[model samples]
Target: MANIMLTKDQWDALQRHLLPNPFKVEEAAFLFVKVTESGDFECVDSWCMQPHDFDYQSAFHISLRDETKAAVIKRAHDTGTALVEAHSHLGKWPAEFSRSDLCGFDSFVPHVRWRLKGKPYAAIVLTTADYDGFAWIGDATDPVRIDGLVIGDVDRLGPTGLTPLTWGPWEDFDGHI
Candidate 1:
């Protein structure tokens, strides 16, 4: 079996929290992960998408922004963690990065590379129904790989499921680490 880099608790907490949003206004969330020398990954910090200078829908059209981008960078800097960016897709999941996602990456990765001196970064694609993530190494357009999540307790398809992770509170659970 391939080694599990992220812990079960982390997976559970992420599933218990983050959820998809269906509003027309675009929403975003910031995430950071601490990567140990041994290659283990742990959550460091997370922030919900707050309305910034850009008009809400404008962010959706332009992709994520510098303030949010800076939050990701700050978390990585503080914890010596690799950067991980996550957001909700409401109820959709495109097979590949959308034009906006690509745009967001184009603006951020170069900053991350310069700040971390070329360290690896991760991106998480989430929906109210399911979840997946990617590790962007050499190129943002081509992720190293994608992983379907196995969230504990919560059924991906159930009548009374919580909103997708983004709609929930931003939490830091030690158990999740």
Candidate 2:
């Protein structure tokens, strides 16, 4: 089980971007992380996607513009950092990936891995109260659940009941960003 470690200030800044007030719609961001020798992801910095970064957005979904995707990928490539995609969910839904999300990952994850020459990729879904995430480690075909989060000195475990799983080859998935 792997974990992500964030400094107090980094966690606070990320929370602010993901759960901004007047939060009528979902938001997305990318956390640039360094893969430590111990196999944990250490947060380096974050890029909060702005409104113009998305080609489509609603309270339930979002699609990033191609240019926005390109820019993030470029930055990650140049900096030799792994990317953890983070997004918000309105209301109080459990922070699990939706079916649409899995479908999207089938395509996007492979593409990103190819582009980045196989750097690990991860995604996290967040609501006001909870978060769940998974990561592709090494060259594994399936992802392992991200087991915990280290915020400053406090180590918080992820929600119970999440198991490692493979995302799919589903056809016709209209996904959120």
Candidate 3:
């Protein structure tokens, strides 16, 4: 399992973008991250999707415009960084990926790996109070849990506090395999 580390300021900025006031619907973003020597992802920058970036959006779903997707890919290509796709889930739902989200990943992840020359790709789903993440590393077919998050010097996702709900093979939900 790998972790993602970001400065306090970066975390703050990302939260603001993700959980804005009047947040009536889900929002999405692409985080451009560099793999650190210690095998963690360091967020270098992010592109928060705007209204015009999406072809459709509601409280439960969002579809990025083709141009928006292309732009995010291009940015990762230009920056030579791995990509982490992120989005929000409204209300009190757990921060877990939906079946629809997994279906989307089936196509998108392979395309991204090909375009980015086999660089890893990841996704994180955030609710108001928690998050869960997964990563497809190298040629692996299944994803590993993104087990922790380090905000500045604090371990926000460690076992003792704010731990994400377990998903994938470790647990099952809604008949998800």
Candidate 4:
């Protein structure tokens, strides 16, 4: 497996997305960090606004919907990219994956492996405020802590002025400026 990872800068960008403006109630923009067979990590595509609704006629929840699932499968199949589904949590609670998160994994893992020819995949969960996150790979039944990752700021948009700027993967608090 490659040493796949996400930078703090990226996380800051994601936090801005969790806000419930005209978009959150209906959808979520899916982002990811894909590790290639060549052992390099890159932030690939972004699903501008993935619908949060799913089957069962329940209230639209915050999560990767079926359409988002299809998109993930296609990306994995076409590029041989391992999965890394990242999304924002919109509250002050220290970021953690909710039940919906597990549901997402249960629904996606098999399809990812089968569709991508058994490539390893991971899920990245972050807070709306960029306070905490974790990575889940291989065993959707298990979760791993991301050591050395911290959030210095949140809600500031990136160069495009639409995405926030998140920073992480720091050795210590090396004076983040």
Task: Specify the highest-lDDT model's number.
Answer: 2
Highest TM-score among the candidates is held by which one?
A: 2
Model 2, 1-177: lDDT tens digits are: 578888999888888988989788889999999999888888998999999999987788888899999999999999999998998888876677777677767778888888899988888888888888888888886788887788888757574334238654555644534
lDDT of each: 0.50, 0.83, 0.80, 0.47
The better candidate by lDDT, 1 or 3, is 3
Clash count of each predicted structure: 8, 1, 0, 12
**Of 1 and 4, the candidate ranking higher by lDDT:** 1
Poorest lDDT segment (10 consecutive residues) of candidate 3: 158-167
For candidate 1, the 10 contiguous residues with the lowest summed lDDT are 157-166
List the candidates' TM-scores in order. 0.60, 0.91, 0.87, 0.56
Reference-based TM-score, model 3: 0.87
Which lDDT tens digits does candidate 4 get at residues 1-177?
233344565544554554544333423444444654554345565444534433321223454457657876786677656655555555455555555555555546677667776655554444444433334445443444433232333322211111222223344533211
